[model samples]
Target: MFTEKGTLPDGIEYDGTLHSGYEIREQLVGDAISVFDDADVTARAVKNPQYLSVCVLANMLVSLGSIPKDKITGDLLMSMSQDNFNELRAAEERLDAKRKSFRAENKK
Candidate 1:
C-alpha cells in the first residue's frame, strides 16, 4: 500500500502495521483548526508536550493518507522537522495528481 521512496531516519525502528482509514476518520474529517487546537491544549497539559505533539502530527499525517502508519515510529517522527512533514505532504499531493491524471486518461 505504501509506494513512497523515502526511508525512516537512521536508528529508528517501528513494527506497527498500517492503520486502516477507519482508524483515523476523526482526524481526517474533523476540522483542522479544531483538531490541532485540541492537540495543542493536550500537549500543553501533558508533562511531555513534545512527545505528544509528535504523536499528534503522526496521526494527522496518517489520517491524511500521506504515509502508512506502520512506517512511522516515535523516534522516526521525532527526527522529522516540520519542514520535513511539509515535504511529505507535498509529495503526497504530487502522487495524488499523478493518480488522478492516470485515472482520467484511462477512463476514456
Candidate 2:
C-alpha cells in the first residue's frame, strides 16, 4: 500500500483488473531506468521521493505490459492541486532538515 497520498490507489479494480504493489514497484524501477538515458542521473532522481513518485505514476499505465501508442506525458501530474504539491514540498523540506541536522552532529 502506498504510504503517501497522490499515488494511484491500490485495491480497487481498474478495467476489471488489479495489480499488487510489488509488481508495480518492479515495473516502476524497470521503466524508470529505461526512461532515463544516463544511469547516474536516473539513480539520483530516484532518490528524491517526489521525483520517484512521478516515475511511479508515469509507469503505472504501461507497467502491466501495455504499449503506449502516444508518449507518456506528465501533464496529469503537472495539473495536480496546489495543496498536494505543497505537501510534497513540505515533506522534502522535512527530510532536508533532518539530513542537515544529522550531518552537523556527525561533523563534531
Estimate every model's Cα lDDT from 0 to 1.
0.45, 0.43
lDDT of 1 by residue, 20-97 (tens): 221221233342333345555455437675665455545544432234455554445665556555555554565566
Query: Which pairs clash in the backbone of model 1?
Result: none
Ten residues in sequence with the least summed lDDT for candidate 2 = 19-28
Error of 2 at 79 (Å): 3.1
lDDT of 1 at 93: 60
Model 1 residue 96 lDDT score: 64
Query: CA lDDT of 74 in candidate 1?
Result: 42
